[model samples]
Target chain A: MSRHVIGVLVENQPGVLNRVSGLFSRRGFNIDSISVGVTERSDVSRMTLTLDGDEKVLEQLTKHLNKLPDVIKVTHLDAGCVERGLALVKVDVSSPESRSEVMQVADVFRGAVIDVSRDTVTVEVTGTEDKIQAMLDLLREHGIKEVARTGVAAMARGPKYTGTE
Target chain B: MRNGCDVVLESFDAEGVDTVFGYPGGAIINLYDTLYDADLNHVLTRHEQAAAHAADGYARATGEVGVCLSTSGPGATNLVTGIATAHMDSVPILAVTGQVPTGMIGNDAFQEADVTGITMPITKHNYLVQDADELPGVMREAFFLANTGRPGPVVVDLPKDVQTAETDVEYPSVDDVKRGIRGYSPTYGGHPRQVKRAAEAISGADRPVVYAGGGVIASGASRELRRLAEITGAPVTTTLMGLGAFDERDPLSLGMLGMHGTKAANYAVTESDLLIAVGARFDDRVTGKLDAFAPNATVIHIDVDPAEISKNVEAHVPIVGDAGDVLGELNSTLEEMAVRDGSEWREKVKRWKREYPLDYEESDDVIKPQSVVEAINQHSPEDTVIATEVGQCQMWAAQFFDYTKPRSLVSSGGLGTMGYGFPAAIGAQVGRPGATVWDVAGDGSLQMNIQELATVALNDIPVKVAILNNGYLGMVRQWQELFFGERYSSTDLDQVPDFARVAESYGVKGVTVERPSEVEDAVREALEHDGPVVLDFRVAREENVFPMVPAGAAINEILEG
Candidate 1:
């Protein structure tokens, strides 16, 4: 099965997220990751969902998402789309050598050390999913404590917008 | 200035909703009180589920948005099955439910439930009116959403405070409400290119079959479907929900196609070179063993719901539009094309129909359920509304009846709810007061909502109920007997009440028919009754619906018993 990222524009109303997510679970479609936020229009919300399915599955998923009254439009963010994900990773750095190693690894990835404690260091990273995965892999050698990720947020690379008229 | 309840009534009036089916409870007392003196006709069903089913039946019969109302918590939850049934069949129904006050919504107040959360997946859309000002808009939107596009059930959960809270906001006009919903715009006309492609496919095929479904009825496309069939000389096979979409007496009609569908229809579909599916989804029941279904055919699917296209079975030419509009386009396009002569294919289908005619063994000792359906058909008018409870009785009604018009057969096709028929028949009778409405039910299915007999008796609804009393859940029993070596588990109804006596107890006319000879007379007597009547026919317990596909088997692999 191929991975697909679909961007949906929906009415910014109460329980609209529940309606969208409920449809996924009800129809037995699996969702890998989903990120939601208000768009340029305050009354509308944009949801970027990463799902694993084939062409037929993606088509079915998009059609079902469009059926929801809250959803305005659904777009498949394919080749010409820019996708990024934000992740916060806290690493165990009890020793000064380990702390410097973590700092160097974070510096190489262009990530910032957002918080530091006596035995732990939290790094804030924003990049493509692959880049974040690569940085996280390097930090894993230093004993990672926790990781919180805001799943991929995507948009078309060109001037054409998702919900634009 | 007006209260939220007044806005609700005004919205109904504006939408031309004359009837509502509901059950009263504490949370909805305010609305019920308002309905007490309103111009709207309110049908008080004995149970909330029956109310929903009746509304659904009304919607199916009249092509209008059926409305059902209920109180909070248990009352609202009771409407769940009916709502899901409507959702599955794409029936246009509006379910209005009362909620606990906004302040007590999350505190576990008495008679409180998350109505919106409960119905999220089952409804086309739903709303929890938190403010009084939102009531008018929500009511209008709920009706519009329920009735438009690929229609289904929509819920409006009104808080007690919202119902009582007053606001002077003017209720929006119908056009305004229709334009206000930005996210919901249903495609009405098929793409011209797709329609042309469909027409070309139809014209080029040597053997073609038109598979119709509930969408044809929903879009009022029966005439268009007939025109297309006549123009192309394609044999038409309908799903259970599409029973009345085309006149069954037509020479080209193949009746139904599916698990319990006719041999002729199944064979036609399996052998056809082109399958034109109009407003019908490739449901598991219809397309048994999906990979093996219509394998040789190039499918052209036209449906209002884009999601339904290529859902179960992939379509070669997918047209998204209302059934009537798409069929009209196809017919026009076909007029300009040289359609292939299908006389040889028609003769082949006719030979199949003759070779595998639907018939049941005649026994003077006991009643055959098929004969009961025939007896009803013989006595009823052409436009009679026949609703059936699920199981063998439902299949028998589908197979035996000669439906001549749309909106005549109102059976639960998608959800297959057992207790759907009686209440739905009541709703159909209410919708068409001058038509003869009959509920053909199995013993187990009829008992599920037999309580609705009180509602019918009270309202003096002249709905005739024919019970095929087999003393068991016959469909499951048939399965057990065939597939499980006669190990009849919990399928038998050991102590089914005498349905006729039960009807009599409800102050309605009742009759019990034991032998085959008594079927016609009982049906006539029931039909003659000016008010509601229940006729219980003790059908042979071991009889099973044949020409069966045995569930997962291909439709062509039918067993004729």
Candidate 2:
């Protein structure tokens, strides 16, 4: 099964998310990550959706969703399009030597130390899905206390938005 | 003399608008200015939401598209909920909203909240007039869209600039209206093969029960449903929305099913070998534990909405169509098959009804909601239209009101909005002037829109309002008592106003009933009143609607009081 990412452009309004999620829920489809935010146009908002489903079901779902009133347009982006996920990892910084070691790994991954205290250091990283996972793997050796990641907020590779006048 | 607002006002007049309900603001002031000089009358609703609902009620009662106007921003947003409610119930309403100027479209204009975008989900269709020239076409389309198809609310957002902009307006042709939309799709009904299949299933079954719902009323198929039940000798059970679809007094009627449904109704649904669900959505509230609901039954679901077919409980023989058309077809098919009454099925249903009956303790003091419903039936004309707000009173009205005719009773069946009845009653009264229209409401629900008393009085609509003032949101409190540790929270409503004074302020006669003896007189006085009247009956607050089966529980294990 090929993992696919789909970006949905919709008119931002109350119950639009509910409608989109409801479509998935009713079809018994498990969504991986969904992020909704305002687009360049104030009237419209773009929803970046990640889910696993049969290709035929996804195709049918996209058409059904377009049939809803508020849904303006939907686009299924290919792997060539650059998409990034943001993640923040907070790990224990108990040992003095490991702190530098974690910082070295963070520097390699282009991750920033967002917050630092004697017991813990919170690293913020933003990149494609694999890069974020790699940063987490390196930080895990230092015994991570907690992690909070914004669930897959995404956009297209170049100057292209699904919503237009 | 040649103002753009006048053009719009004249168009409304031509479209047959006798009355409109709305609260005017700065954006709509120009339209109101034109209305003031014109013969068109407008009722100043306290809230824009009420105006929308009032328009919805008016539409439902009259079968014409209801019209409401509100200013931009909050005024438009307030109308959203009511619009959604009307859409949910499939009532035709045309909402006119004022928006900021076309130039001030997206600059965060004051009193502007993108009403067209916000209402897209709620409305069947909406139009935002960017050009003044587009106003006539939009208005014409709004009316057509609302009144046609499944009948739902439509909105036309008139910018202040557009309302005040001078332009030559021409109404669009009907062909132009249907160009973009496929409005001619027929709602589902009986197909020949499915009707034959249903008849065969019914005849072959050992025990069969007819589970009817609100769609029966919408389809105007109550008599047909009853006929099918009688012919098959299958006892009838109704969901909360399905109450009046069956005659409550009929011997074969097992009363309401689901949570708060009668023991017999629930028992019949559970034990029946063949479950025939007509015009009913198997709501979780009705089905309880879906796996356990109608366990032994080979369900045959017949509904208008394709989505409702096999959405919840799977149907062995699914028929998506109008209830009237399908039931009529099924009857003909049954006649062809020469299907006779199954004596064993009839005997089982009768035994269930006799053993676990719809029972309520007779109290000589406090006024029972059941008694109030019955009294309304006896006092009012048979053709009188009764609209009930949600809660215990809604259930009681659905149970006790004898609706031998179609569309005689209006209710917030799908959404169950609390404050629906008062405005709906006003709309009903206006729609059917000679018919006695009564808004049967619980105190908590009535207070939500008791302000509509003013609309009633001002319009001289004279709709009788019966408030079963139990001093609590009876339905919720009933649940708390049954499910929770009986620790009633926000349900208890105390320090109520003198309702008589409230009614008097609105220039309507008010009657109060405390004792059971006063019930008859109060209802009688309310009925006889020349204008709008309020009968506030301070009935039992703690009286729970009985025969309630908690959700997910077996239908047979009902909580009877």
Candidate 3:
């Protein structure tokens, strides 16, 4: 099985997401992550879904999605597409030495310190999955207290604008 | 004033909706009022649910979109189960429900039950008209969606005011209607590469089995399916909904596959190297113990609905298109490809068919449900339409009836809803005037919508009901007896209603068959009836539908009793 990311443009309407999700679950699709947001056009919404399945399974899922009344278009995002995620992690800074080390690690990853307290430092990291994971691993040594992640949103990379056609 | 009701008439006229099965109620009085003067034929049913089912039967029988109407609240809620039944079977039906005045929506207005929300999941598309102006467009889209690609039921919830308020009734032309609805286009022709791949797989395999489903009939692909099977010389099997899609008399016919399926069909599936699934979803009942189902076969699924292609069985070569169109391409591709000799495979399938022919015990006192259905099959004219309710009777009918034509056998295959057959028979009879229609039902299921008898009688629709009155919910009873050690918990009917007498009271002909000898005569009498007729056969109460693969058991590991 291979991972496939599909970007769908659907007419902005209530319950379209539920319909899309229900279609996936009905076919036993294993969706790793799904992100939905309003696109450049307000009348249409974009849903970027990452699912793991063979070529046949992905093809069927794509067809089913297209059958939805609310769906306008579906694009199978290429493998070389750009995918990014955002994460916020809080690390305990009980010791001065640990706090200094955490700051240095955050600087190297280009992560910004969003909040600072006597016992904790909240850092915001934005990048592809690997970059986010590397930042989290570094913060772990300083007793990472909490982590929140926004699932990956993806798009095809090209010279011309890919407006979900 | 040309009101929303005029919009309804104009829309139906433009869509070529000749008949609507429905009932009049408070919320939809305006629609009923205008319907009285409209150019369409309206059959007033006893209940809203029956109307929905009748519409489904109508669609199944005629291969055209069926229409049903109901008032809001209890009326709309009543249509839910019927809508779900149509959805499951992929029957194209348009249900127009009258909601409370727009202002009263969501306020729990008397008799209102969030009709739109309740029917959302069950429908292909639904609309609660926000403006009277949108009524025409919604109706047009409802018909288009319901009859398109994976044909299914669609709902249009019109408020009382919407139907009463004056509005311009401009029925959009077909092309104009197309532009308004986006994102729901269904592919008719499959990808050429996939079709060629499927053809190659079929040609390469010696033991290939062609399994088809209801989609074959819905897409009018049965003729193409027969040609494909003939060209490949592979054995063919159908799901219950797929009956009549293939000629049962053909040597290649394996009847049906799955739970309670024929021993031959089940064995063919297990032993086959290539399984060509046409227009069929791998339903649990049809694929007992999913993991072990067709374990040896490489599946090639062709269907209009992409979701169903890989929903149950993984399709090695999946084709998402209209069944007829896909099968047509497959047939053409196979014509050019190197054809393998499937003669050996054909001989083995014939042997399996001979070894385990469908049968039942002969009783002197109680009617064998199988014998009753078989007798009907014998006495009925060619091309008789048979609608069945859920339970043992449904299985018996499926096994015994020689369905030779598409749309000849209509039943609740996917949802397995009871009380479906009787109303569906009404719809079928209404759709094809002069055609004989039979509701092969179980006592438990017949009682669910027995009220439809009044509608049948009033219309003089000559549909007949053959009730396998086993005095218990036979299917569930059989399960309880086998799996639950015969606890019989709530499975037995304390006092069975005299369904025949009930039908007589509704001004329809009624017959009761208690002795096994009377099965043939009773079926004949019912068939000859001028109006609706009900034949209540006091069948063997303890009868079981067999070749059953006990739930969760492998398809090949069946109890062939």
lDDT of 3 by residue, B314-420 (tens): 78999989999989988999999889998888999999999999887787877888998899899999869999999888998999999889999889998999999
Q: Which stretches of candidate 3 lie over 4 Å from their true place?
A: A1-5, A21-36, A50-61, A76-78, A83-153
DockQ values per model: 0.84, 0.06, 0.47
On residues B387-440, what C-alpha lDDT tens digit does candidate 2 reach at each position? 888999988886676665556777776677888888877767776788888898
Instruction: Predict model 2's lDDT versus the native.
Output: 0.79
Please provide, for model 3 over A43-125, each residue's C-alpha lDDT reduced to its tens digit, 9 standing for 90 to 100: 88888888778887787777777777888888898567898888999999998798888888889988899999999999998
- Badly placed stretches (over 4 Å) of model 1 are none
How does chain B of model 2 score on TM-score?
Answer: 0.90
lDDT of 1 at B397: 95
Instruction: Evaluate all candidate structures by whole-model CA lDDT and list the values in order.
Output: 0.92, 0.79, 0.88
Ten consecutive residues with minimal summed lDDT in candidate 3 chain B?
B176-185
* Number of backbone-clashing residue pairs for each candidate, in the order shown: 0, 7, 1
| Among all candidates shown, the one with the greatest lDDT | 1
Question: DockQ: which candidate is best?
Answer: 1
Error of 2 at A41 (Å): 23
